[model samples]
Target: MKINFQGAEIHYSIAGEGEATVMLHGFLESSEIWEEFLPEFSRYGKIITVDLPGHGRSGCLDEIHSMDLMAEVVLEVMKTTGVKKANFIGHSMGGYVGLAFLEKHPGMLQDFMLLNSTPQADSEEKKEIRDRSVELVKRNKPAYVTMAINNLLSPKNTGKFSEEIEILKERALKFPTRGITAALEGMKIRTNKTEVLKSFSGNKILVAGRQDPLVNIKELKQLAEESGCGFISFSGGHLSYIENKVQFIKLCISSKK
Candidate 1:
């Protein structure tokens, strides 16, 4: 279904029934990415999957869709669906949105987990990389999406998931350059949320990938330990939900602190 927000259409899907649980997908991905796991996840509670602004069927709301803006969109979805409080699971960029949500709407969150994501802001070097990616997307979107999705997977599994990679690329290619650049710009400016994690009064989980190229697993593990949040790791890369589905599901299910 779609919710009209700020003159843009925000696409979302709802399944099953019980305590609400929201699932937010990463960059270049849509709510569809969670389709395979929805049935199983819904067994736990009502699962709501959302397409971030400028992603999937959702429309871009601004030139730069900040993490805070995306969080507000999620909040609107919850309100539309009559969800007062819900657990959250966010992957990559989606995790950044989750932290922003916590910062602004603390009372609405029952708990949250960051999957292959961090509470830290983008480093200068990473911001430079995002700048480069923005330019690349403007010049050659398809090529950039292919390379970006490939880089998200573990090198060892690239060949193993070639067909899956192709599908992902096709979906990512549908994103407009404007949306892509806006997302990159937003990510470049996000503030460090480590303190947000430390001060949260409810449960939190930090799931990292041993071979993740995008996140520093050691640093994230340290943050999790320091903040007293549960930490889990797997032999995979950034896309642990795809690379290690079974274990990832178990970890998420057990994250209800």
Candidate 2:
């Protein structure tokens, strides 16, 4: 189904029954990524997936789709489903949106799992990379997508997961220059939400890949400990959902509470 958000069309999907579970995809990804795993999730409860602004079938709302903007869109979509609260399983950029949601609507959350993501904002070094990435996306989106997706997995699994990488590239290549750049810009300016997670009354979990190129697993585990959130470490990289699909699915099913 679809909804009108700030005059832009936002596409979302609903499946199964019982408790509501919202799965948010990472940057350059659409709700389509959850198609294969929806069956497992739906078996336990209602699963809701939405294409953030400028991604998937959704239309772009602005030149810079900040986390707050995307979080608002998520809230609007959930309300359309008549759900006042839902479990969160957000991947990468989606996790950023989830943090934004919790920060804005603290009482509207049941449980949260940040998969291969963090509540920390970008450092100056990362911000520099993001700015460069934005320029690269604008100059040549296909090349940037190709490089970005490949870098997400552990270098050791390059040959083993070639097919999976190809699939990611194929879908990511469909994203528009504006959509890609907007996401990068938003991430670049995101604020640190470590306190937000620490203060969340609901259950909080952090799932990370041991060799994630984008996120520092050590820091994630430390944050989890300091914030009193449960932490799970998968034996792979940033794309744990793809790198360790079986384990990732098990974690998702087991963590549903």
Candidate 3:
């Protein structure tokens, strides 16, 4: 179903009949990424997936969809659905939004997991890259999307997951160029939230991809240790859930407790 928040229509889906579990998709991705696992996940609890502000069936909100703005959307969605507290799982950009949620509603998180994501803000180098990306997308969206999806998977597994990558690219291509650029702008300016994660005493986890080109594994592991959150590693790239589905599912189920 869809709801209006801040004058923008947001798309979301909820299934099952127990505790709430919110799954937020990453940049260039929609809630569709979680559709395959809905049946199994819903069996464990009420699973909620959102298209966010500018992806999937959701309408774009602003030229810059800031993390806090996205988090507010999540908050409003939860209120509309009568979810007071829920387990949160975020992938990539979705993780930044999740951390914002943790900060905004500390009492509302039963558990949280960062999948192939981090709590750190974009570095200066990354910011420059994002700026370039915004301009590039405006000029050639498909080219960037295709290249990005290609590089997201480990080189070793690219051939093995070629079909899946193509599907991802197809979906990404459908996302509005404005929305894509807005997300990039938002991610570029996000604040560091490592301290926020450190203070949470709930069942928090950080699933890292050893081969992830985007995240710094060494720093992430250190963050996990310093924050006292559970750490799990996969031999894949940024899209750990796709690169390592079986292990990802097992970890998700175990976190349901």
* Tens digit of per-residue lDDT, candidate 3, span 24-101: 999988999999999988989999999998899999999999999999999999999999999999999999999999
Error of 3 at 245 (Å): 0.3
- In order, the Cα lDDT scores of the candidates are 0.91, 0.92, 0.93
Per-residue lDDT tens digits for candidate 1, residues 1-257, read 99999999999999989889999999998888899998888887899999999998889989899999999999999999999999999999999999999999888988898999999999999999999999899899988998899998888988887887788889888887788888999999999998988889888889988999999999999999988898989988999998898998887676432
| 57-109 per-residue lDDT for model 2 (tens digits) | 99898889999999999999998999999999899999999999999998889
Clashing pairs in 2: none
Output the worst ten-in-a-row residue range by lDDT, candidate 1. Answer: 248-257
Best by lDDT: 3
TM-score of each: 0.97, 0.98, 0.99
Error of 1 at 170 (Å): 0.7
- Sorted by TM-score (best first), the order is 3, 2, 1
- List runs of model 3 lying over 4 Å from the truth: none
Most accurate candidate by TM-score: 3
Ten residues in sequence with the least summed lDDT for candidate 3: 248-257
